[model samples]
Target: MENKEIARVLWETADLMEIAGEDSFRIRSYRNSATSIEGYPERIIDILKDENRKVTEIPGIGKRLASVLQEIVDRGSCERRDELLKKFPPTALEFLKIQGLGPKGIALIFEHHQITTMDELEQLCKDEKLRLLPRMGAKLEEKVLRSIAQYKMRTGRFLLSFAHEAAEELKKYLAETGGVEEITAAGSLRRGKETVGDLDLLVTGPNATEVLERFVAYPRVHEILGRGANKASAKVGREGLQVDVRALPRESYGAAMQYFTGSKEHNVAVRTRAVKMGFKLSEYGLFRADNDTRVAGESEQEVYDALGLAWIPPELRENSGEIEAAGEGRLPELIELKHIRGDIHMHTTETDGRASLEEMAEAAKNLGYEYVAITDHSKAIAMANGLDETRAVAFARQVRELNRQDRGIRIFSGLECDILKDGALDLANDALAELDLVIGSVHSHMNLEPAEMTDRLLRALECPSLRVLGHPTGRLLMQREPFSFDFDRVVMEAVKRGVHFEINASPERLDLNGNLVRSAKQRGAKFTVSTDAHHPKHLHNMWYGVVTARRGWLGPADVLNTLPAERFRNAIRHN
Candidate 1:
């Protein structure tokens, strides 16, 4: 099993144990171990192969957990997880996918109504029968209905991050199978869409038969749907995510890749242009219409060169005028991961983060960062153990002392302060004035009317200490929608106040999405791409944000954090 698969099973085990009323401490141990395993940079199997290694060296893995991991790796399954599966009805686990329903809720429905399937649950909601159960009132029943609808809408799609994880693992596995020359993931994944329906892989090599055989035999393959001489399809893991693989000869690799990695609109536009140019473009190769003379097909660049244009980036091939830009040579040089100099929005053990200040600093320094900001939660978010005014002051002092130590990376004391519903700052001006930076955000009252939300944001931006707005929309992809507000007005106000917008890099909340970023950029508003990381490993999420920014057509100059530390400080000060 892959690390992600093993971690998923362990997480499900924890959820099942919670419903079964197992010991709380034991359940926490399982949850912690799963988190650590999922975030681990290297494969657990690689670690196990080292003679001097011990699984216990991992943060949350103890002797018992290590034994379980070994069992999963060696036998392709864990006995404990199998035992847990036997305790529930065949369809009971499906309830976990329904929002507004926890394991306890599922257990209650099963005990009282014998509801074992999604169809039964939906029927019960339609009949208003759910309200008969404990804690299920009219409001709760309505919420359950909405949740069911939302869950159904998102059933077949997977988050970009999740699909990327699976694709990377599969790519590595196939590349290691001797005979494969080149491999790449295509389709929506190549376009960097926020969500994808399925993964499409293209491979070119001499050992097509060997690659096909190896793919079907993969441990994570749940079912083989079809197989052909050079093409294969399968549903993988418990999520039933479909994967399709196509093998091609080296000569046709580039044309086939461009053909497959397409937005339908973009493909139509390209085909029209090819027709106008007296050439036939296809997966086979670009050819002259009258003589069938092959022109270009070996590389993607060559294919575009034959079309009298520069190569358009995959992220910009959305039929959004990118073809015109490429033809006119007006495409922006999009920001890259290497262009990022620091991350300004992150947390520490000071407020709900897994890593400490020093550990986060070291990790940023390791990434060749010139600076990092410790922007923990304010008191409004009590669950994160947010800091009060006095605590904020002391934290600032501590950061100053750490800077004095010259740790190779500059540490800035910052606060992710709450913007209250009444348009008041959570911290006093005196406290805010002491910090190197301030990030104001909405933590509650997300249901305000459009005008009210706009007014609230306007007030927050008026604060002199406020530098950036974190996750302006407060959206959690696949779980919540952005609140209603006048986005244009908000962007205009941000520009007037000189408060930069944030492109939060967290995979779950890539807020100020591509569309919004582009809109803001047209208005001459600057942005900061922040990881919003709570764990050290999450710092790597910067790549996702950079891709999102590129999709929005943003250049390096449009992002504030790309500046050197000294220049960045000056810009923030003047703002």
Candidate 2:
């Protein structure tokens, strides 16, 4: 098993243990081991198979955990997880996904009622029987109902990251099969949608029909849904993400790619344009309608040229003015990963971050960032050991000292200050003034009414130190909907106050989402694309933010940190 696969089992085991009322310390050990293995560079299986090496050498892996790891690598399962699964209904694990439901809540639901499925659970919530239970109340029932709706909406759909990883694996496998000449991701994966229902891969190769055999026998292939001469479909990964692979003839590769890599609306618009111009466009080729003679088929560029348009980028293939822009030669030069100059939103060991300030800076330097800001949490998040006024000021001094060193990267001291309930800053103005940048965020009271949330954000923007608003919508993808607020009003105030919106790069919380990002851009708001990194590995997630930026039609010029360190520093000051 891959390290990620092993870690997933360990995590599920921990969650199941929690539901089983296992000891707190033991459960924590499982969770910690999962985390350790997930980030460890080397393959745990390789280390385990080597007689001279011991997996226990890694932190957090004790003798018991080491044995558990061995069992997992050997048989892909452990005794404890099997035991837990046998005890709970099939939906026990599934119920944990509901927003307001916890393990204890699931355990209670199972004990009190013979609820077998989601429909029954929804019915239970509607019947108000859950409020009679311990800890859960009427509010929770309402929240669960909403969560179930959201969960239903997200069902069978995988996150873009999940599909991307799966695609990379398949692409690598197919490339290694020897005859594959080229592989291009099509569908929403190519377009970089935040969520995907399935993946479509278009391949051109000498062995057109033979690749399906190798794909069907892939180690991750859980089930072969179908097989054909030109295409093969399979359920891949533990998540059962559907993947379709097509082997294409090189002559029509571009046409197939353009037709298959479509948002249906975009495809319809382009096809209609072709029809009006007396051409028939299809996956086979673009041809003259009268003669049925091919006009263009070899390249996406040629296909677009045939349509009297410049080549449109894959990211802009959503019929949202991209077609018109392409015809007029006005499509944006969208932001790329190379255009990023810095990652300015990050945490350090001073608060919830796993890495020290020095370690994070070294990581950023290795990533070729011109500058990085150590934006640890402010006092509002006590659980994260967030900085108080004294600590915040001391941290600023420490960062200033670090800036004096020849570290090969510019370091900025900053805080992710909380926008508290009453619209006040978490730290005092004196403390905030000492920092280089402040990202005001809503960490609590997300349930506030729209007008109230707007007022709170508007007030937070009044702070001179607050250069950016962090994760403006407060949404956890597939987990929580964005908190309701008058986004237009808040963003207008932020723009007036010289504050930028943050496109937080964390996969789970890619807020502001692309829709909001585009909306804010229309209202004259600029953005800073940040990973909101809490660990060194998280720094690599900047590409995901770049994807969100490109999807929102952001050009490099629209992003503030694309500037060099000195210019960027001056721009965020709001002076």
Candidate 3:
């Protein structure tokens, strides 16, 4: 078949399996392969005809799948895949992307009522056809229609951080209207949640009428949701971009900002703490006056100080022990990106990476990293151009010679060894021991039951040569949830075994998310935040990982890789 035909088939198959609720990893392989084919610079068939052709060397195509791909290319179809694709049409795949509509849910809606396309699906949902189906009701139908309308209007939502940019744009417009004095973002956007539901803006202005008029007339204002004297809300663009503006007096600005910026739980706790301390907390400001005399205002810290506590970071202000820690003066001095002395996980051309060993080392030097661990893929993950012993030994020699050069950065020979189903490392211990750091990871076998999966992971952690576990949860955000595992117990076992956990910095896979990173830190497990970068551009993913670490309240001393070069080497050697 033609390349486009093959790509279409693969995409449809993956979508069908998604509707079937098949194992995510297995489903992901097909999706990744489809993406690879679609984006590949060379034609798939042309690449297949070369003598040196090895499809398995592609980043997303593993050995077994590569062979299957060859068969599909030769025969113009995969009989098995075609049979599966018949269950779900390509047109219906669009419905699955809507919020609250998983593949199984879509399949159920389609199966019961023969819903086949987005328009049909939307009408059925709006007309309450889904309510007549099992396990669905009027409320569910309304939610489905709303979600469908949203998806139809928007490509996707913005990341939580990006919401600040949108809020700032609207704020600046309102500020220039000659009535507003101060503006800020509130709600989950301010608290650093990964994804925001909508953007919320609060402004203190002199004239409510003028400010409201200006907001409604703004160039980007697509639709006005509501407008009142004290508050006005609107949606911008097809993405449902929301901006909320509130008018407040100068006296109440600080308190209002703090209250609105808080996670509701955090606000409740703070207010309770204030009441117990014989003060009242509100949007106007913290006050001790029973007869309306001012006590604290002008600054958020002063308000917190009046209640007797240090300021807590927005990321940790989830009412998750942050207030108590502040009261006890035990808030961790969170680590900064500058403190990272070395990177223990990275990729080079020995695998599917875009850079060679020398190039990666020089890049590390430029970044001021004291050391770079060149952990290319191990043999078990052939799709990543996983190295065999012969090639690995040669690469080791190359890295060693490079290390001896006059470069300022130290280079550590390393491999991201895949953990097999039988709880064995992809490379032998002796082979791994020759390296400075060995990162054990699960690249497959996501279908294992929770108990079995936990055991498999624990066994991999027990490897003496294994120094770090990479992306232990195996989740792909928004696209897929992590595989089933008792992460608490996993953290406990990792701590007990003296193995390190990795915060994979690949933007697509900031694996050990901030909350879990904090949880693991509290359990005595050391961490190394590395980019797991496959290309030069990906090295910056470390910044996201750092923010995640800070969210977990980790300090410089808590990260193993932030040690001085000598100490970092010693830690590796000792482990």
Candidate 4:
């Protein structure tokens, strides 16, 4: 199992245990281990397979938990999860996906109503029945119904990172088999969509027949949905993501990639262009209208060249003006991962982060970054033991001391200060001024009116100490919808105030998504593509942020962190 899948197994078990009213310490162990495993840079399965390695060496992983991990890897489940599923309806886990309903809430509902499916839960809400439950109210019921609708819309979708892992694993498995010369990912995975519905792989080699056969027998293949000499389909991984693989002739490789890696609209546009040019375009090849002779099919560049356009990057293949931009030779040179010199929004152990300040700085330096910012939580987050004024100023001086030691990375002392509901900054002006930067964030009151939310952000921007607005939308991908707001107005104000926006790179919270990024960029707003990382391994997620920036048509010049150490320092709002 991949590290993420293993982490999910333990996390779900922990949640089930919590609902069962199990020991809090044991539950905390499971939760901590899950967090550790999820942020681990290497696959847990690989460590288990290595004779020299011990799974117990992983922090928080005791011998018992280690054995549980082994059992999970062996058959995709452990005894604990199996037992818990029997005690509670398995669908109770599904109920946890609702925004307003957590494990405790689910337990309350189950104890009172014994609801099994989403429909019953929705009915309970609609009937005004849940109001009688402890701590539940009419407002909670309304939120539950809305959350259920959102959950249903996102039921089959998996995060891009999850699907990417599955696709990469399949590629590696197939590469070992003969006749698999090249394996390339296509579809939404290639396009860097935040969520993927399914996976698509294109393969080419001398003997495709053997590859197709090997594909069906791969270890992760839970079920072979279909099979053919040149193509195959299967459900793979614990996520049961449907994967389709096509083995194509080398001559048609590029044509097939173009046809398969498409947004339906983009493909339609490309095909229409081909038709206008007196050529036929399909997965096979580009052919003359007057004859069946193949024209350009060897490479994507050739295909685009034949169509009298430049090759569009996969991230820009949403048919949202990329085709026109390509034809006009006006496509932006998108930002790349290598262009980033620093990651400015991250946490350390002093707040809610797992890693300490020195450790986070070391990880950043190892990644070849010249600078990093430790933007730990400010005083508003009581649960995180967030920093008050004295602690915040002390931490800034501590970072200053570390920088004096020339630890090889310039550590900027900062705080992710909350923006209070009444449009005020969480930390005092003098406290914020003691730091290099302050990233204003909203951690509560996400359901404010659109005008209120807009005004809230607009008010936050007036704080001169604020540099970057952290995860501006406050979205958690499929789990939560963005708070309603006038985005353009808020972004315009940020630009006006010389405060930049942040492209938060956490896979679960790639907030300020492509559309919003592009919208803000067009309004003359600058940005920082940060991981908002709480762990060292999470820093690697910068690539996902770069992909998001590319989708927004942002170039290196548009992102402040892409600047060099001193330049980036001087570029942001000076304290």
Candidate 5:
């Protein structure tokens, strides 16, 4: 089975067991195993093939979990998952997808009201029956109604991060099949859309039949939708997300990739240009329209050159004025992952993080980062075990001691301080002055009027200790909407105050999204693309932030954390 499919099954089992009131340790074991499997760089099947390999070597996979994974690889399903499904109505799982609902919430509604489906839950909310249940109110009922609407709008789409994970595993599996020469993921994933409905994979090889056979027999294939000599389609996992693979001869690889990796609008624009240039363009190859003579098709650059333009990065192939820029030889030298020098917003066990301060620092060093900031939560976010003045000061002392060891990476003591309802900071100025940097954020009162929200942020910007704004809009994709506010005014005030905004790299919260980043950039504002990591493994998420910045047309000069250690410290001090 693919790693994502295995991970999905394990996570679903965890959710079901949680609702079943299983032992907390067992539930946590499943959760941890799921996380480890999802983030693992290689397929478990490949790992298990080594003669000396032991599944116990995986961080969270003990003997029992390894057996379960092995069973999934041998068959397409697991016994534990099937057992749990038998105890609940088949439709019960669907309710968990609704926002404002968790395993506990679903169990409560099911036991009390026998609600098993989204339709029944929506009816209860509309009839005002949900408000009579425990912990349910009129406001929550309204929120549920809105959440259902949003959920329906987002149905059939997977998060970009999830799609990328699946694509990576599938690509690796296919590449090792011996006959595959080149394989590339196409479709919305190549375009870097925030969410995608399905995946398109294009392959070129000498043995087309061998590639097609291996693709159809992939262990994660839940069902084969169709098959042919050179193409096949299959549905994968419980979500029934379709994946289509097409094998092509080597000569037409580039043209097919360009055709499949398209925004319809961008493809139309390119074809129009081809026509104007007295040529024809198709997945077969570029050709002379008058006599069907082939021109260029061996490479992507050749395809672009046939139309008299430079090669455009896949992220910019959205028909959003990228063609005009390329025609003028003005395409941006987009930022790459290697250009990042530091991660400026992260946490440790002092707040809610799972790793220790030292572990987080060592992980940053492993990533070749010159510096990392420990921006734990401040006192306003009590749920995260946020630090108060005394704890904050003590934490600074610990950081100082660690830095004194010359650990090969600079550690900056910082706090993700909360901006309170009245625009005051959660930490006192005396406490803030003890830290090397500060990241101001909003943790509550997210439903204020637009003017109030704008004023709240503007007032926070006035504080001399505030250096960066974290998750500026407070958005969680597919679950919560960004709180209403005057974003333009917020950006303007941030620019005037010399406060940097963050591109938070957590998968669920890529806040200050691409458009806002571009808007801030156009207005001469600087930014920091940070992971906002709470665990050592999460440090690798920095690449997601870098991609978001590239989509916004940002370069190395637009990012503050790219500076060297001394210069970065000076920049933060001056701000």
Candidate 6:
């Protein structure tokens, strides 16, 4: 079993221990071990077995936690962790994942009515089981039900790219139909947050009044949630579509965009810096020494230059030392989407994707993209209907025919080959060599110890045919965490061996997160920011990867897809 899986089990054990009224320090140690195990640089087994090694060497772990880590890694389970969990009903820890319920509330529920599951809890809520208990009442019961429903109905936020596209569509429609001249998507979508909460568009046109009127009256506007003279809110299907239309002097457009696209913390940092310099900054523009007159600049860069600071990358504008970096003129040259010439990771009908070869080609053509790597899954991924050697070869032939037809898009027949349990490639080297690109990935063995998982990935990276590692960490948002692995070493080796890693744009799996991306970029390793889309609509998710790339402070030149098709193909073919 992997160290990460072991850690998760141990984490649950700790939570259960907490519910059972175990010693606070004891429960805290287990929880600490869980967090430490997540980002471990080496395998837990090696740490456990080594005489000189200490688990306290791992960050967030101390001496008490170290022994627990050793016991879990060496014996596949820890007796202390198990013993504590046995005291509490197993359901106690399970309820902790629910948002509103805390340890105390859970204890009350379990102690009173023996509620073990969500269903049982719901039944208790229906039967007024909590009302009879001391302190709990009818209103709290309703709130709990509401919280439970919310937990059940909760969906992850859309990727920034999806929000951008939606904004673009809305902007275009508003301008064409609503006659708005200045339409821009503001908020996190503009600032390039990795995920977006909602779509915010600011419009400024000759007919501001008419535009706002028409926007609120548009057919797609399901209900007028709110309407004021300067701004309005409406329901566009289920997602909250908040549209704000305000009348401002045209010169302030740039500042307005910057202000609205703020990480509030970042803006405060900038404002404080401005204050220190004896100047006042606002969304309207930079003011005079007295903080009253507006300066000239219709662009964000101009505004920053006026303040003697380099324009900060939107992704890094989260107040995390970016202001200091900007002041020092040491801002990172973020990666740009235009630098991506080709997409090295994608799917098609051969696996579990919506597009056909021709449709994908045409879409690439429309995007002015140079090339695409069609990496269908191999036979091992039965869930995705992966291809075998025979089918893979046939797919290559079809790609060759398409190339010959001069479709204006270079097609690289690639395989998203699975890394086997024993740290071997799913395809033979010869089979792998036939493809233009190879995106080796780990789908199983996710529960392996950090060392084993790292070894598995490293072995795959050592394969010459492996050009790109898709979603290197292999997380599924809140559902799962990356198993224990030596990511630092894995990235170092992948970079040294000329392997490309991906910032997968799948909403659920934005693996190779901004922090990791920054680390890899610093080492001169290349990356492919791909949508990893399963449907046509998903292709638009490229923006999510784009935003994530920006968050890593990546510029266009860092990504392989930003290259033109021929150059991209040559790079992959040779590397």
lDDT per residue (tens digit) for residues 1-575 in model 6: 45666678778777777676768987777776775575455788777778898767776687766766667766666787567556556767657766556777777776767556777887788888878877888987887777666545534455555566667766766777454568777777777765676666776666665666777877657878777776777766434555454544567777876787788898888778777777777888777767577763467787787777888877787887777788788987776656666666778887987668667767765776777778889989998899888888777777777788777777888889999987788888877888888888889879898888888888888788888898888986544566778988988998898898888988778887788888788888788888786655567667678878888878777887777666776788843
TM-score of each: 0.93, 0.97, 0.70, 0.94, 0.89, 0.68
lDDT of 2 at 85: 84
lDDT of 1 by residue, 407-519 (tens): 89999889999999977889998898888889999989998999999999989988889999989999888777788899899899999888999999888888988889998
- Model 3 scores a C-alpha lDDT of 0.78
- Candidate 5 differs from the real structure by a C-alpha RMSD in angstroms, to one decimal, of 3.6
What global local distance difference test value does model 5 have?
A: 0.86
Model 5 lDDT per residue over 214-297, tens place: 888887788998989878889876677788889888777888888888878888899899999999889878899999998988
Query: Considering summed lDDT, which 10 consecutive residues are worst modelled in model 6?
Result: 237-246
lDDT (CA) for every model shown? 0.87, 0.90, 0.78, 0.90, 0.86, 0.75
lDDT of candidate 4 at residue 502, scale 0 to 100:
93
Residue pairs with colliding backbones in model 1 are: none
Off by over 4 Å in 4: 1-3, 40-59, 63-76, 112-115, 123-140, 573-575
Q: Candidate 4 lDDT, tens digit per residue, 333-390?
A: 9889999999998998899998998899899999999899999998889899999999
Query: Where is model 4 poorest over a 10-residue stretch in terms of lDDT?
Result: 566-575
Identify the candidate with maximal TM-score: 2
For residue 457, model 4's alpha carbon misses the true position, in angstroms, by 0.8
For model 4, the local distance difference test gives: 0.90
Ranking by TM-score: 2, 4, 1, 5, 3, 6
In terms of TM-score, which candidate is stronger, 2 or 5? 2
Which pairs of residues have clashing backbones in candidate 5? none
Q: Measured by C-alpha RMSD in angstroms, how accurate is candidate 4?
A: 2.3
